[model samples]
Target: MVPQPFPRHIVDVAPSVGSTIWRYSDSFGLADPEAAEARLGLGEGGTPLMPGMGDLLLKVEFVNPTLSFKDRGAAVVVAHAIEQGAERLVCDSSGNAGTAVAAYSARAGVPCTVYVPAATSNAKTLQAEAHGAYVVRVDGDRAAAADAAEEAVGRGEGFYASHVWESSFLAGTKTFAFEVWEQLGRRAPERLVLPVGNGTLVLGAWLGFEELRLAGLVDEVPPITAVQAVGCAPIVAHATGRHFDPAPTIADGIAIAAPPRVAEIADAVADSAGEFMTVDDVEIADARRRLAEVGWYVEPTGAVAVAAAGQLGDRGGTTVVPLCGAGLKWPGP
Candidate 1:
């Protein structure tokens, strides 16, 4: 098969420029979705929004195909890569993104290589491998794994499908806001709380809401409350003028010592009248247990949203917190 030429840069193609590729693609605005070669049989979006503890509405993202919100972005990134005729997809992830890319690439019949930190959860790495991805364990931290992936991609070994750097991926994640608005009677919620690692979900939701407002779909965007693990919160530290050295945390998903988009996250939160809150492992564990009692059963990282919601102290309007990953990926309590 002849290789399709890759785009020189990723552009936010207007919705008018493309047909509806998925129910949410109308909101995503990626150009030429029908031309994308990758098509995963597994349904990617439409996670349920249900009632949660203390006036919190839960966006149950853990029910996705790979049991994490990462599937949303991976679906788009993999599709775009296939459209570009990539021989293989490559990415570096702590866990969820790797599993997501693995699953989507498998469905697309594309080869995949995922570089993951050695400390990544065993269950997550196993899941990636189960999806037929070649899992390469890198020594050191998440950033180190990312660097290795970049270097390999730089060598033209495979096309890079970075969750953090890819604009198309955010197009998929942006559906979160659209779904929330639709779920809440086509109205914007009062507030949104979610865990932040590389700030993909938070940033994507911001983009989603911004697009809605621009399109005159919603009058106002909700205040987005971004949650971070106390152990590793560059965004929070920058926002509050606090200093922190990265430490171990149960919320591995948001344990990003130096997020690539920290400034963007801080600026977006500030612009939206939202604030950043940090929760320790104990708080995350407690939140996880509470969610389990309520029958949610999410990973500690997913529980970070709930844990931070408790710290917000009565925002009053309807608040949505995303429960992003499944508890089955970690050891049972």
Candidate 2:
């Protein structure tokens, strides 16, 4: 019973957009056809292997359907949209998520509207547009665009496909941890490092392992090591006894100044042996370059885990890191 789980079906779309295209039908394809696809590698699971990043294994979840782990959740989101008989869908993504939702909506023959910050990366915005989604470029910051999208949806515009507060997306996203288990031969890691934004990767993976444990498929989830950009770490501020701080980091992906799921994110870290850390733009850039040199192209946000790894103490066991997004999604500086 994780908090606020989106219906298994609406994992991808935010409720602010339109009718959901997903359903709460089954577990990570435990005995279902879609689950089989998850195994058989039809661009489903099995992201990529970046061996020996540390004692922790690196699962390149960024390689999913839309070139990011977001695709997994987006699949659930769009599927539910169909079930709800939505005529169109709406979403506000800083980058990857909008592209993911738009692409999946196209696959399902559903129209999608994406609201993006005017400063959104060109590559990501282009990707969403290429997917046949109507791109709404709002003036002001990312949150402003999100607010506008919500308002539009509230006015009977379309499904919101809001990712921040949606719980189902986490359920869909949890599948990544299960894939990590299968990739690691069914053994849970001692620690999992993830780059946090709205708590998607952290929360999603947390729930996935819990579900597996409930089904007796695994024993326990490892303590998670969640990292964020120094400029935009709201939870880190909270963790360090700060009531609130204004974050403004260039690791734009995880530079979330305010997360609606703050309480939940903090609870997950505290409950597990997890700790949250932050890295600077220089560190984020360095990590990005290093990962790319290894042929693992990751965005600045995706590389925060790698940057944090440098500061982490010995946990004395395996740790798993989610290499979240593709570098290509970011346009040239």
Candidate 3:
């Protein structure tokens, strides 16, 4: 027997609820209109855009409800899951996505189970559990946890609220672009520097900008540069024509050995005329220190993009880098 098709993750149109996505609802793919309306309100979006060293403007996403940019996606995904009659929500995350799912699921009154890689920070795992989620630590890598979550979903145990696979989550993340556009005086930036694990943020930003350009709201979409840890830089390797063997990096959030959305990410990079880059752990740690010294305390993962900004060097335009997670999420100096 042929297997049934899963629900379409993203749609062309979403509901207008006066949030960051309302104006662009006609451009996004949303799973449930009711769930979109029922989305949790924990001050997820509207993060501040602050001036950083040089021309790099920092989109401070660490102030989000879950202390990470993942909340932007999780709010929409969990609400959609509940509207679709899901009794339980399941996902695999390095840390931030799991915490986001757990928090949103709790808000929606649904049980949540998050599978996290063994190397996930204790602070993040504890945050997820604090939201009343059942946390399972997978042995191997982030991909291993993703495999387990997929297996559970295939067994009909729960709805897979995957941050990577769920189109709505990407829609939620697209708000970053919209916010940036508005913050930048209704214009698109010249470049966007972001960290890529599953490539959710990069993809979402591309979609959002594409919609805006199509709507004649923006003249152009900014080139979106992605920063990956040197240890696990598949997209970088693919783009640069270099062989990659996964190593260890402090940017655990983007330590994805095999990203499920590599093709899509590569497409976004090409479409935006952007580039992929890699930063070693030492560089990440140094960047983290610099950011902290400047009073912007972000995790090592969030510092990857900031570290990469040095490579751009006097690009004559507004460059934006999203500080994706809080520094306190990890335990270190």
lDDT of 2 by residue, 24-83 (tens): 236633334354223222244556556855555678877676778887777766665555
Number of clashes found in candidate 1 = 0
lDDT of 1 by residue, 1-333 (tens): 999997698788765422112676645454656544236636777888999588999999988899998888888888878777798899999899889999989998889999998888889999999999999999999999999999999988799999989888898888888889888999999999989989889998998898889989987778988988888988989999988777899888877777888899898888778888888999999999999998989989999989989888885889999999999898656
Preferred candidate (lDDT higher): 1 or 3: 3
**For model 3, how does the per-residue alpha-carbon lDDT over 1-333 read when each residue is reduced to its tens digit?**
999998878677766345444444444455544445555556578788999577789999998888999988887787677767889999999999999999988877789999998888899999999999999999988999999999988988799999989998998899999999999999999999999989989998998898889989998778989889988999888777897777888998998888889999998998999988888988898898889888998889989999999777897989999999998899776
Instruction: Rank by lDDT, highest first.
Output: 3, 1, 2
Listed per candidate, the RMSD to the true structure in angstroms reads: 10.5, 11.1, 11.5
Q: Which residue pairs does candidate 3 place in steric collision?
A: 11-29
- Weakest ten-residue segment in model 3 by summed lDDT: 19-28
lDDT of all predictions? 0.86, 0.75, 0.86
What TM-score would each prediction reach against the true structure?
0.91, 0.86, 0.91
- TM-score ranking from best to worst? 1, 3, 2
lDDT of 2: 0.75
In candidate 2, which residue ranges exceed 4 Å CA deviation?
Answer: 1-25, 28-42, 52-54, 243-247
